[model samples]
Target: MDPIEAAIEEIKSLPHDQSFTFSEIARKHGVVRSTLIRRYKAITEPRTVKAVKQHALTPDQEIELVAWINRQNEKRLPPLRRLVQNWASEIAGKPIGESWVGGFLDRHQDELIAKWTKGMDRDRHQADSWHKYKRYFDFWHAKMEQYSIEPRHMYNMDEKGLMLGITNRSQRVFTRRMWEKGELRSVLRDGSREWGDYPCHYL
Candidate 1:
């Protein structure tokens, strides 16, 4: 609890004939006397609690908005700022200001972040599923066993390609949990043909 609130509670708990004044309780708890008095008399609530009521969306509506953002992120299609602003406007029954999105993002920074998405080829994205990777690894392990291959003889190859064109990077909102886990970077784009490849090998 806040120091002012704690002081107010202490004051309220005093006996009717006790010799404690608001100033004494405030000094004891290291809070301002006038603030303690206001709080004790129920003249105001904590600033953090009051700020919620002043938000464009109600608490319940903001929660629903967060849920929608999470669902979009799970589909690998996070919403852009304009889309979020429009959704918030619809929820609040009024058009939000240009700066509302920034404030909203700041308020929910723990749960969300705005990030530039890396482009991924549609075909490559579709082919990179769990089952396909598992099958490839399983077949490789079987072949290694059949050939009696030693670990020292194994070679790994990695291919890096550069597409020679300007690619647009759009900012999208994603859950901080996914970002921390390194899962919020890629978004599908059209296949590219103008490319240069460099191959590296390691054993």
Candidate 2:
């Protein structure tokens, strides 16, 4: 079953008392709690869910999320509730909820996500003589060979690329707590990863 669909059905099967909190569902999936939030609602509606699966992270909040997640390291990742709270606080330029921190963490499975994360630096430029003058690179390469010097001068000759993926859509909590099958996908996106549709075959 689809992750989101299965999540919803699971939530519906649960008792209403427990259904009101997404943390419970997140734990079941072993994902962090933020996995459940979407837009102004913690639970993503089908409409928003469709957009996300399509890889459209253009929503204002989502865009902001990508920027923040990309710049930080996975090690800086705090507890789910704290992560969400910090996300809001950082984006809104003010403190929000402390409880949200924990709620968010419960949504994602830490183990599976151990290698998944946000942010990257891709704008660093290298003054490559290769592009300016084909002969420039050859000259450097040849020069280094003559002196037996390490080709550190032209070691790196290309610019880096940055790709940010959607971690959470971010939703508002209507009731006291959050409840939803917290399913977060640790997606990686960059120019190379960009495509009009999902690849036909999964790697």
Candidate 3:
């Protein structure tokens, strides 16, 4: 039970003729006097209870939504804000306001986060499996051993083409824990073509 709730119970257990004032009891329980009075008099319910009564999604529905978001993120298809809003509307059986998603995110901040996703080529995404990576690394290690290669002998070279004035970034929601562990960030996209042919000469 919450400390304040426990304190309220204790206050109720006190004898009617007890000399302890409501303020004194509130102080002893480390709770606000006004809040204690309100609760003691049944003038108001707990904030959490009130919030539940007013929230569009029930506790169980919210949990389902959170799970759905995480599943989508795991599949590398994290949802956009508008998409989330639509899903929430479906769950609530009514359209939600623009600000509802913001509040929902705040409520589940520990488990979910919104971020702008980096675009990853579909080919790269398809190759980002554990089996493929392990196979590639095993082949690389075998080649290194055959050649007696040392780390100091290795020189890495990379070449990338950029299309000027083109961006594929989009804001999406992801699981906060996965994001922290560097598991979620990129959104898959087709990289076969570029919007522009502007040359960026390296200096």
| Top TM-score prediction, candidate number | 1
lDDT of 3 by residue, 59-109 (tens): 898899999999987765678888898999999999888688888999999
Candidate 2 lands at a TM-score of 0.20
Q: What is the lDDT of residue 8 in candidate 1?
A: 72
Greater-TM-score candidate between 2 and 3: 3
Model 2 / residue 16 / CA error / Å: 38
lDDT of 1 by residue, 104-161 (tens): 8898899999876456565555655678778977987877788777777875431222
Badly placed stretches (over 4 Å) of model 1 are 16-19, 117-169, 180-184, 188-203
lDDT of 2 by residue, 120-193 (tens): 32421232224545676677667677767764444331121221232332332211111122322222222223
> Which order, best to worst by TM-score?
1, 3, 2
TM-score of 1: 0.59
Which RMSD does model 3 reach against the true structure? Answer: 13.5
Better of 2 and 3 by lDDT: 3
Cα lDDT computed for each candidate against the true fold: 0.73, 0.42, 0.74
Best by lDDT: 3
Scored by Cα lDDT, where does model 3 land? 0.74
Worst 10 residues of 1 by lDDT: 157-166
Better of 1 and 3 by TM-score: 1
